[model samples]
Structures are given as C-alpha cells and as structure tokens.
Target: MLRIKGTIGDWPVDLSVEMDDADWARLAQNLPTVAVAPSAQVAAQPAAAGPADKLWLAAQDLLRRSGSVEGPELMDELEALAGSTGAAKGLLVRLRHSPKVKIEVRDGVQVFNWVEE
Candidate 1:
C-alpha cells in the first residue's frame, strides 16, 4: 500500500492510500457515480461561525459610509479583518449588497473602491 498526497498546483490538498490491481479496478468501475448523495454533500459543508458573521456586519458599516469602497485602500484592512475574523468575502458582499469591489492608485497610494446597490 502507498500513501499519496501533496500539491498538484498552487492548490493545497491531500490524498491517501493508493490501491493496486483488483482494488484499482473496483474503484475504476464506480468512477461514474459512486456512493454519493446530494444531501450528504450539502450537509458536509460546515456552517459559518457567529463571530465571523459579526465582523462582516461591522464591515458593512463601512459600506454604509459610502455605497462602495476603494479596494487598494481597503484591501489590507479588508483581508486582515476577514482573514483574522474568518469572514467570507461572498458573505461580506452579499450582506453589504456590494459585489463590485476594485482598486486604484492616486498620489502613489493604492485605493480600494466598491459599488453598492
């Protein structure tokens, strides 16, 4: 038996326990659609955390200041807040009703901006 794992590209992932001969053939036979349920997949995704939820709520405060935000000016702030607080970008955008996020440069300072609905 062999264990296989590690990166295929920039993506970080893990694969384990390589099989041979008969075992490989058995797995190959089920490749089309093997023992998977849609509900199981939906359930497997973990629920979002509450603190992260709150942080995003706070980010929305910035959105209220303006319909959008400057990306470059706020990327560090946004990424830091989101990463440290475990907030999801999708959630942030959805909650704030601002999907158009962007960056710009002025007077050598990069600025971040977003459009709100």
Candidate 2:
C-alpha cells in the first residue's frame, strides 16, 4: 500500500494505492528512466494542516464527545468553532456524508451520532 498526502493549490489531497510486487514491476517497466547524481535528490516536505482541517477535527470531536446532538445545536456549535455560518454549514454537510456519522430524524428533529468503529 502506498499513501500520498499533500495539497494541490488550496485543496488537500490524500490517497492510497495498493500494489503488489508484480504490479509495481509492471509499472516500473512502462516508465522512462532518468539518471541523476545523488546530490540532486531533494528531501520531501510534509503537508501542512489547513484551517478547514482544524475545524473538521473539532467538529468530529464535538459529535464524538456528545454521543448524539441535534442538528441545529450542532450547527450552532460548529458556527462558533468555524467563525462563520457558511463554513459551519459546509462542515455540517461534510459530516452528513461521512461514513462514521449517522443522521436520523427523531421527533421531527435531525440528530447526528458518531458511530464507533
């Protein structure tokens, strides 16, 4: 398995690819070769966390700690954490689509629950 984490422009990129030795060898066989002196190699830099990432962590923590919270109440907390209504709503939408979160309507109110894996 190969994991790649980086940013493109302003967007974050995180991906993983699984390849066996034979698959890797096949890929290498199709690629062009270039020779470079050892001194030409450059060290890789780690990707930096952005503000949206910070807010995401906080939002996940909020739901996890609460066990369950009403959607409106969660939005209020997210708004404070993100410092803007749009940003908070964006986070809410992200949570709605996340595999670890579950949303249900109870008494006509939407509730978000963090599912433990």
Candidate 3:
C-alpha cells in the first residue's frame, strides 16, 4: 500500500489514495479542478449533521464489510472519513470500543478482520 502525507491549502490534510505511486501522482495532478462551493444563502440554523452522520455510518459499514475490508484498511478508511466529514475523533475511538469486534494480530500488530455477526 502507498500512503502520502501532506497539507491541503494549510488545512493540514493527509490524503491516502488506494492507487500505487504512479497513479497517485496522476490523481494528484487531476485534483486541482475540484472546489468547495460556499452555501448560496446563510441558513438561520446549522445546515445539517449529514457529514457526522455519514462518518458514523461509514465506520459501521467498514466494520460490517470485513469480509472484504481488512482491519488495517478499515482504520485507514475511517481516518479518511473523519477528515472529510470533520467528525469528532471520538467517533473512531468509540467505534473501536464496540464489544462485538473481530481482530487478528500480525507481528504484534493488531488488525481488524471482521465484525461479529
């Protein structure tokens, strides 16, 4: 697996793409086109909790898909989710504390393999 750590516009973004080195560079070159659009009109109340909700749901989905999602990979995915959603770090910590969990140890490193059915 290849990982790249860097900042995005001083936001201190750490991005990890699934692609190998060559592809990662290609993807990076293609990234400048994306933009964040501001809301058209200011809302009286907070827009919504969609991002936070998505973050938690994604965490659960990653755990539930251990048949295809490896433990280490799940952690990576969760971190990315948290970054994109601005979800509290506590979400990941809480997710890890779920009693119904499955894991494996490799060279003293713990990895999640699946979630309890």
Candidate 4:
C-alpha cells in the first residue's frame, strides 16, 4: 500500500494505492539489486565513488568557489564541467534539492548559493 498527500499548485492532492503479493513480486523483480559485503569485509574497505559522485563534487566546488552565481551562469559552468547540456541540467536539478545548497530569486533572476555546513 502507498499513500501520497501533497499540494499541486493551489490544489490539494490525496492518492492511495493497494497492491497484492503478486504485484509486489513483479515490482521487486523489475528492480535492480546491489551486492552486499560481509560485515568484516565492509569494515575493512571504504565504499567506491562512482562517476556521478565525482560530478556532484565538482558542481558543489564550483558553487562554493563562486559564493553565489546566477542560474544561467551556473548552468554554463555546469555544462562545461559535465561536458553536455543534458547532464549539466541533471546536476543542476540535483543541486537544487541538495541540503548543502540554496536557491533564491533576486532582481527577477534565480541565484544558486552554497550553504556552508
């Protein structure tokens, strides 16, 4: 069972979904799984960082060094860092949702800023 409650624009939304065991089995089968390390093995090694983690770090570094930057300029810099407009957009979306960053509108333009921990 799943329940979702939120507001869409000015409208309130409430949703509910119920699934049987078979449905859950189908969902699980469609999902990807990661291999887990044994307790001792895990404690002995640090987790590996993937490409997305590297890109995210670079994006954060860019914003931190700039202090604050307008959306368009930030997008331009992200595009260069990501090497593609599509990937840059993805990074921008991730940053927008990140706890370490904040977005504000000033002079009718959106600005992205790094939130120091």
Candidate 5:
C-alpha cells in the first residue's frame, strides 16, 4: 500500500494505492536496468572551470554594464549573484586590485569603475 497526502496550490490532495505481490512482481519485471561504467574504466578528462571562475566572469560583466557603481551596492549584487557573502567579498577584493577595474572615492563612498582599454 502506498499513500500520498499533500497540498497543491490551495487545494488538499489524498491518494492511496494498494498492490498485491503479483502486481509488484510484474512492475519490477518491466523496470529498465541501468548500466554504470566503473571509475577505472572511464577516460581521464580535463578539469573544468569552477564556480569562482563563473563568478569572476559575472562580476566583470556587471561592472562593464554599470561603468561605475558604489562599492557596497556592487558587493550586494555580487553576493546575490554568487549566492554567498564570502565569495562576493573575495571577488570584490580581487576586483579592487585588478588592473581592469579602478577604485575611486566619490563623496564618502568607494566606487568601482571599469577601466576600458
């Protein structure tokens, strides 16, 4: 016997199913088999760029689009984009020292500007 109870949208749902041994046996017999290759048998592959690489690219794009943006605001956007505050802060620090980005002060706020070559 299988029972499922849940809510879909604003409506409640209840479902129950009962199967005998023969039904279970038939179902199992019709199921497909999956074959998996052993790790030793698989070919070696080149390493791929990780999430940090992707975040760096995204940070570059965001700066390019905005020309200049406040440091804290940029950090917030990067945090949302990276889904991690630590990652965002790390990227911001990297950007601050990057030759392609220029850090300046406007009024009392630090601003990041994309340096175009």
Candidate 6:
C-alpha cells in the first residue's frame, strides 16, 4: 500500500494505492533499462539546454518584445510556449520576483514589464 497526502494550490490531495506482490513483480519486470555500447559509452555527452533554461529565455524574449504585458495574457502566452500551465506559472512567479523585472498594478490587474537598463 502507498499513501500520498499533499496540497496543490488551494486544493488538498489524498491518495491511497495498493499493489500485490505479483503487481510489484510485473512492474519491476517491465521497468526500462538502458544498454550503452562500450564505444558509445566512452563518448562525451553533448551539453543540452534544459526545459527551465528554454523557458527562461522565452520569457525574457517575450517581456522584452512586449515591453509591458498583463499577467493573465502573459500566462496564456507562456503556457502555449511552454506546453504546460504549471511551467508557465512557475516562470511567471520567477519573473515577478526577478530584479530585471518591474511589476505594477494597472486597473486592478498585475502588469509585468522588463526593466530597461
């Protein structure tokens, strides 16, 4: 049996799952394993930009191009660009606190603007 309790935003989550021995055995059997060739294993892995890096760059570009953008509108655009609401929200929060960003409330809504140097 597995139990999980947590909160996502304002919502509470409580989940319980049970697995028998056979279930665990089947799951273990189906788990994936990587088989690297000896020659390939010796090769250096290429540096790749992670999702967060890409998202940060995209967010910076968006803010720079738009000058100032409404919070909801920015969130929508970010969600489309990042392909996930959670990622968009995380980026927005980071942007909100970034020293390079300027936040203001306009007509009861938050507006985010890139601070020009």
- Every model's TM-score: 0.31, 0.59, 0.41, 0.60, 0.57, 0.58
lDDT of 2 by residue, 8-101 (tens): 9999999987767575445434332222111211112123633344446566777888989999999998887666787677667667766789
**RMSD (Å) of each candidate, 1 decimal:** 16.1, 16.6, 14.3, 10.9, 20.2, 13.7
- The better-scoring model by lDDT among 2 and 5 is 2
Error of 4 at 110 (Å): 0.4
Question: TM-score for model 4?
Answer: 0.60
Name the best candidate (by TM-score). 4
Candidate 3, after superposition: displacement of residue 1 in Å? 32
Instruction: Put down candidate 5 lDDT per residue, 5-107, tens digits, no spaces.
Output: 8999999999877766565445434333222221321223223633344445566777888999999999998777666676676567667756789888999
Compared with the true structure, what per-residue lDDT tens digits does model 1 show for residues 14-98? 7666455566335323322222222432344456523333444445555445544554435445555455322333333343233
Q: Per-residue lDDT for 1-117 in model 4, tens only?
A: 545689999999999777565654454343323322234323344457434545556677778878899999999988877777877776676677667888899999999998999
Q: Count the backbone clashes (under 3 Å) in each candidate.
A: 12, 0, 0, 0, 0, 0
Q: Give model 6's clash tally.
A: 0
Q: What overall lDDT, based on C-alpha atoms, would model 3 receive against the true structure?
A: 0.47
Report the lDDT of model 6 for residue 28: 31
Cα-based lDDT for every prediction? 0.44, 0.67, 0.47, 0.69, 0.66, 0.66
CA lDDT, candidate 4, residue 49: 41
Q: Between candidates 2 and 6, which one is better according to lDDT?
A: 2
Of 2 and 5, the candidate ahead on TM-score is 2
Residue 83 displacement (Å), model 2: 0.5
TM-score of model 1 relative to the true fold? 0.31
Candidate 6 has an lDDT of 0.66
List the candidate 2 regions with Cα displacement exceeding 4 Å.
1-47
Q: lDDT by residue for model 6 over 1-94, one digit each (tens)?
A: 5456899999999987676656544533332222222232123333373334444555667787799999999999877765678767656766
Candidate 4 clashes between residue pairs 3 or more apart in a chain or in different chains: none
